[model samples]
Target chain A: MINTEKIVEVQNLNFSYGQVNVLSDVNMSIHLGEFLAVIGPNGGGKSTLVKILLGILKPDSGKVRVFGKKPGTSKSVGYVPQDFSAGRGFPVTVREVAMMGRALAGKGTTKAEDKDVVDKILNDLTLIDSSEKRMDDLSGGQRQRALMARALAVEPEILILDEPASNLDMIGQTRIFDLLAQLNKNMTVVVVSHDLTIIPKYATSVACVSGNVHKHDEAEVTEDMIHQSYGGVEGCPVELVAHGHPHRVLKEHDH
Target chain B: MMELLSFGFMQNAIMASILASVACGIIGSLVVVNRIVFISGGIAHTAYGGIGLAFFLGISPLLGAGVFAVTAAVIMALITKDNKYRADTVIGAMWAFGMAIGIILLDLTPGYNVDLMSYLFGSILAVPKSDLVYMFILDGMIIAYILTWYRQIHAVSFDSEFASSMGVRSDLIYMSMLVMSALAVVLLIRVVGLILIISMLTIPPYMAERRSNSLKGMMIYATLFSLVFSLVGLVMSYFFNLTSGASIIFVSAICFFLSLIYDRVRTSK
Candidate 1:
């Protein structure tokens, strides 16, 4: 039974690309302001699931809804598509790129006030100095932030991200996580990541994906679960707290 | 040179160049920004099929090319939509087939060993009054479309997926762009031959892109640059007895090179 209050609802969702089953019978519901982290191994249909939710791809069978409407209806869904090709040499100004988020907001003419709004967004994202610079001139971390600024300008009620922190360093990663935490305070946010370390600190609920679906309810993700989810290695230390209970990560290991 | 401009043919060539350049430059800006240069090139060449059909059917070649290119542009637009990456391959195949069919049809058209060179290579020196009227109408339509939906076109050209998410039907906008580009190609077929049409389409904007920050600024500068290139090329062609179309493209090429040098020098400074 789907809760009517759910912002995103997916049931019996199966997706495949020409006989390769990526996801099967996946069921999940995300409530308003919920921060859900989907962690999985490579080739675990993480991106496939995100694309389906964004209405970019359709499932072979199942149901999906956004904000009590179709997947694409909520112009309020801000998706920063997995940065597959955002490299240097894409010739566009940071301000121009960010303005794209406001492209659909009932067009007439961009008033002088709209420029001020974009300027504020650039400042909030710490991109104000480089707003006039071409996208190709920005560093990788700055480029990622520019993409995020674009997404933020859309005023999305649901923010969906795919491996947004994969390219960032330790500082970059922490800054992005902090931003996500602040964003999730007001909107529903779903992030798909392969990283297991950052899941517990920020994710309100963790969903494990491995061609199958497993849901955990606010449980502190244990290292044993990570090992089980990622497939255990031979030399990795494993400790048992009790039968049927395992926790390998201690305070020292936590970043 | 001033006295030569008194002739109706010389005046017509000048008008044709100005009209065709403005239309092509504006449409070409969208093409370059969207990375649809090759597809626009394909549309320009494929217009030959329409010319051949017009000759065979005893109608105006411009009308025939207009009808045929518009139809093909729509089909090309549809096939390419939802598959932006693979669009060029489909357009390339269509371009080759369209050209082949046109040549075959031209050969089969009876009572017509018509000088194919004039149409294929362009005869700006021989442009008629009727052609000028046609150019005027096309120019009007182009201006209206650009004025009414300029912002939407800019957004779609920059990033279509983002545009569509914003309630703009990128499919519709993409199709409109293809149709307009094809029409512009059809208009330029007589001013500059199909062989040289894409150069006119690309060169002006390429030069303008170096000096401008916004797309609109690039287009306006391109129009002014194209006008200067056309006049210089015309005078050069008249004096040297060279082909008008080829001479025009040569002057534009020089401008493109100069623009590149200027940008390099400025950046170094």
Candidate 2:
């Protein structure tokens, strides 16, 4: 049963790209302070749904609400997109990028306060050392942290990240998840990841998106569910196997 | 160089170059960082259509180019935003088509003897006082816009998705930036001409990108470099009797290549 203290609510959402249906009658809810993990096969509309929630894309039909407001209208939601470039090779420093997070919050704020907020966030994210470095000069994991620092700098009630640690190593990924876990104590965290190694252990709830959405509060993802999840999608068998084991693929192969 | 200041036209040319650099530096940094050089290029060439339309209607070519460039910007923004795969083909077509329109329009206007070469290259030495006034106002507006919206522009340019999540209108900012690029093209065309506008827009920003650590720094460096290149080229043209526009572009090209060397040498060292 869905809880009453929902931070995000998606009701009867149906999205299509011209002819093909990306999502159909999708329904999901995220409660406050819950670490929600959105997982799915590639092209299963996982990122699309996130984009809709970020107000980057508008759904054809249905509703996506964050904090009782439309996705784009909500200032309390922070986002770190997949492969976020801080204007790569274009002289945007980590500090400057992080400061951009405070641009919208509290009008007519002093520059010193903004700088202080950005500095603390960078320190918390362990990005203070490289705060002065150009975005392109940072390693993938460092860049990912810079993006996270930027998102967290906004001090959002709900922070969403699409494949936040895809560029990071397992150690780096663990550190990020630890950081997310710490943040999730007070703030809601929504992470879109394909890596199943950490999700089963860390996520308070997991939502598997594949044409349809299946939310599990216990965060256990069975191999059968993973296999059956990709049943509707074509040419996803290889990718499914790539992420982990597949019971459905063998079943389909036998057929 | 001493006698250059004695001539009113020379003084005006120097002042115009400084103003042009200001516009180019700010807008050029955005254009480069946003990866919309091709769009700017298309606008530069497509602006010719506006110039031609202006000639046909007996209006100022700058007005026509401004209108035409904005229209081109709208079209470019639409397709490029929705479907990026078709952007190249669309840009290529728009680029040639705009130039062709301008040429045809210039051909149709019988009584006026508009120097097509001047429009193509530049007439920096012949920059009228009225045009400088226009550039001055535009330069002020541009600086103010950047200063007022630097943070928002930073958000949109780097991670628009994050920006939108933070309640910034990334799409509007992006479109506005493209339109501003068109405006920059209009301002620079008289100083450098349509053919060399991209150079003014991209070269300084490209060089400044490596030297600076922030967009503001990049913009400042770009402005300084643009001014230096403009003056150096202007002086070279004045002494050698070369075309001012080509000379400026020549200076930029040289600096670009030299910066490349500097980057390589520093990296290797």
Best by lDDT: 2
| lDDT, candidate 2, B88-197, per-residue tens | 89899999999998989888988869888777898788888988988888788888889888878987887777777777888788888998898899899888999999
Candidate 2 DockQ score? 0.68
Model 2 — TM-score against the truth?
Answer: 0.93
**Which portions of model 1 miss their true places by more than 4 Å?**
A1-4, A18-20, A82-91, A107-112, A209-213, A217-255, B82-89
The runs of at least 3 residues in candidate 2 whose Cα sits more than 4 Å from the true structure, single-residue gaps closed, are: A1-4, A107-109, A219-255
Clashing residue pairs in candidate 2 are: none
Q: Can you tell me the CAPRI class of model 2?
A: medium
Chain A TM value for model 1? 0.83
* Candidate 1 chain B, poorest ten consecutive residues by summed lDDT: B158-167
- Tell me the tens digit of each residue's lDDT in model 1 across B80-164: 8767457778889889877887888888899877767766767788889999999999989998999988778876776555555
